[model samples]
Target chain A: MFLNLFLLLAAVLCAFQAIRARQMLAAALWLACTSAIVAWLLYALGAQEVAVIELSVGAGLVTILFVFGITIAGEEIQEVGSLVPWAVAGGIALALIGLVAWFVLPAQEASTAVSEPSFSVMVWENRGLDMLVQIGLIFAGVLGILGILAEKETAEEQARASQKTPTSTPPLPQPQVITTDAHQDTPIKEAHA
Target chain B: MSSELTITAVTVLCLLGVALYGLLIVRNLFQVIIALQILVKGALIALVLAGKISGQINLGQSLAVTVIVADTIVAVVGLALAVQVKRYTGSLDVKNLSTLRR
Candidate 1:
């Protein structure tokens, strides 16, 4: 009972934070949290395989990707936009949420009949192709990173520019000094005396 | 209430939810990543709990292994992005990243 309450509270908290946050990064975080909670709920519902995928792909990889994209693309806000659009969007979303909740409430609590192999075996062994596709997706991501880090003609251009620049001042010439004996100067001084 | 696994599963879900919320609401990229980590952990917990309830060792082990891989993938990607952000903007705050904004 307590755990259930905690889950409920966490879900509520994540939703509230996601809705109220103004920053894009913050919104992304809240979204990740929401997905995580849903993943856990899925597990509790006995869909362990689905839960793992949800957590890994949705919460972990997706969140990082989102942050990466946001950072790469820049998430800065130049101005505070009007709230009119926000209100409309919120209203529509809330209405849809209410409708879905009402529709699913009856079946939401209904326990699924536990199968022999369960959903786990089905996703893993039966859907190996999907897993292969997922691996490909990861490989694509790595390639994308490599593409970003690849240095192009920019470095060469910089080097050429430095080579072409002229020197501001000529190098200082070395000073030449003739060595004179101190004893010779003393003899001249004595003759003068 | 019914079983330890069930209770744990529910708790994990709630934690995941909270982490997601944090990820969405926080403006700081670091905070978002942290929230994402929490969310991932919650999901892992849920998977493990389900494995326990079902009495299937193979499913649980495989699921755990996959989750770990996913975790590593996310961490690597997230670190790379974080470094890139720092390199470009000199700050991790998303609000400061308006160079590409139209």
Candidate 2:
């Protein structure tokens, strides 16, 4: 019981930090902590598969992504303060969620029965295609990001190459100053004068 | 009423609530991500707890695993996007990201 409470408190604290932390990196860390706690709770509750998934994906991979994002874009996260109204809004939202959960979740989940927890079934069942689609979504996201990050000059080069209309604006000839003996003699005469 | 179960469930729920609250309140992208992770964990725990309460074994576990996989992919993509956005915008603040049209 004490352990559960401790975990719960840790989860809450981490969650609060994630939400209220000014630094994106900090938030990501807090989120990872939260994920870890959840995984632990799952294990404690006898849901080993869930715990593994949460630990591997949520706590490990997702957190890494957040950190990577922070490192790649900007290392600093700015603080914005507007508390009263936000708090009020949040309170209302929480109340609504609580009400909904109280009324709905139990009833909906009551039908869950004891079935063999087969990994293959979970992976390749009707929902297997969903995973593939999700992967496709990630691929599209990567492509889109790459497209956005491509330098303007490369894009221009591509355009020029594709157009195949080479304009004959001859590259400017290298500057040449021919110095004849006559010119040297004049400079010498001027120096003497 | 198993005191252990009750205490664990309530505590976990509270923590999850706190994390969700943080996610909603924090302004930093990193913090938001952190809070999101916490919220996800909380939800996973809640599912597991529900399973325990009902004496069901793996249903909740399967869902938790799915969430984990989804979170991983999402994080990878999110990080990639963050890096690209930083390179493009020179800042990580979510407020600065106005170029995303959708």
Candidate 3:
């Protein structure tokens, strides 16, 4: 009971910091901490597989990606001061919604019928297609991200080539593709501009 | 007072509300992303609680795994897009990009 309360308190505090911290980098770190705590909460609640994945991907990989975002963009935008107004307004609004939901939502009852199925049946037979589709979705998402990043890199290379190859003086053949995207459109551009 | 009453689920849902408020009001891309992550966490907690109550732990685990996968995918693609946006616009501020047409 005390552990659950402690987890709840930790989660709330971290969530606030994650949302309201002035520096994006700081916010990202706070978010990582929040993810770690949530994973712990899941573990305590007996959702071991969920907790492990949350620990690794949510806390681990996402945090790394967020740090990369900060480094790449590297523009520091300070947080707006004073959480009072936002907090009060948000809390009140949420409370009102919850009040409404409590009455409107149907009461759920725990199933009294306990038919024990083996873990293998639950996983392989019942959930095979579900897992298969999820794997495919994640795989496709990864490929999409890679393709997007690659496109940006090639665009940068083309822009550089355009810069180096001068026209008229040497009469080098006109480059085929136009300005890869825009000199002004990317993070590297921020450095030069 | 009943053990069957899901007070914990309510608490988790309240946390989701807090995260949702942040998501709605915040313009900072990173903060919004954090808010979104919190929201996902809240949902995962609620799912676990529901499964526990319904005596369907395996079903809940399976659903939680799906949510985790979806959350990861969104986190990745969303951050990448945010980076791409920053690259083109030279600012991380979401309001700065006003174009409706591609």
Candidate 4:
């Protein structure tokens, strides 16, 4: 029990750092730490299968994706906006959620049954439709990411082509005239004329 | 409620509050996505905890798995969009996206 509390506290701290960190890479790393802690918490809660999935997808894959995004986007260290209004709003919403959880969650009685089906049976038999939907969602996400990246590549190519155009077509060169004497006013006057 | 359950609930609330506050104040698109991820993580814990309390552990685990898959997709798509936005606008600030209105 004490260990669980410690892990939860650590997770919250990491999540707070992730939100408050100025460097994008640091923030992503902190988020990964939080995800790892959350996975541990899930394991303690008897959701071993979910815990493994969370560890891999949330802590591993998501962090890599965030790092890749940071590298591509580049970090912008803008001044944080005033937080007074946002804080107040968050506090109110949090209070509401707390009230709901307090009142509604404890009302459900825990089950006493000791025997339960295996995780595979639960997922494949009871949640088959959800699995199918998840497959579709994954496919859609891949296509969407591909489309977005492809558009970025095309935009970059167009920009490069536009930049190269001026260099490709050189400007006409002007003729240079050399003077033999500083006192040669006739040539200068003729040129001016 | 059990002490362990109470602690879990408090943790969930803290995560949710922090994520909400971050979402409200963060201007960078990446930070916004991070906040969303935090928010979902809190929901995932709450779902599992609810399952444990109500004696539907398998059901909760199955649902949590589904959520993880979905959340991953969200992160991927969000990151892809952030990259595109940065490429077009030269910055990751969400405010710059307002130019799209024009």
Q: TM-score for all predictions? A: 0.46, 0.70, 0.79, 0.86
DockQ order, best first, reads 4, 3, 2, 1
| Model 1 segments more than 4 A misplaced | A1-124, A151-193, B1-3, B47-71, B100-102
TM-score of chain A of 4: 0.78
Question: What is the lDDT ranking, best to worst?
Answer: 4, 3, 2, 1
Candidate 4 lDDT tens digits, A8-103: 789889999999899999999999999999999999888988998899989999999998888877888868573347768677768867886777
- Tens-digit lDDT track for model 3 on A70-173? 88878567455433367676876588658845752454656594564654576667888878989898998989899889989997999999989886678545
- Native contacts conserved, per model: 0.03, 0.55, 0.41, 0.69
- Measured by DockQ, the strongest candidate is 4
Task: Give each model's clash number.
Answer: 20, 11, 3, 0
Model 1 lDDT per residue over B1-102, tens place: 254444554455445445544444455655556566566666555555555555643465456556656665665666566656665666766666675354
Off by over 4 Å in 2: A82-86, A104-193, B99-102
Global lDDT for candidate 4?
0.86
Better of 2 and 4 by DockQ: 4
lDDT of 2 by residue, A1-193 (tens): 7777777677777776667666566767767777788778777777777677767777776766666666666667465564336777578557755864575344333345565546557656745775676677667767765765575458567888867865677545555545567646542222211
Give DockQ: model 2: 0.44
Q: Model-by-model lDDT, in order?
A: 0.58, 0.63, 0.76, 0.86
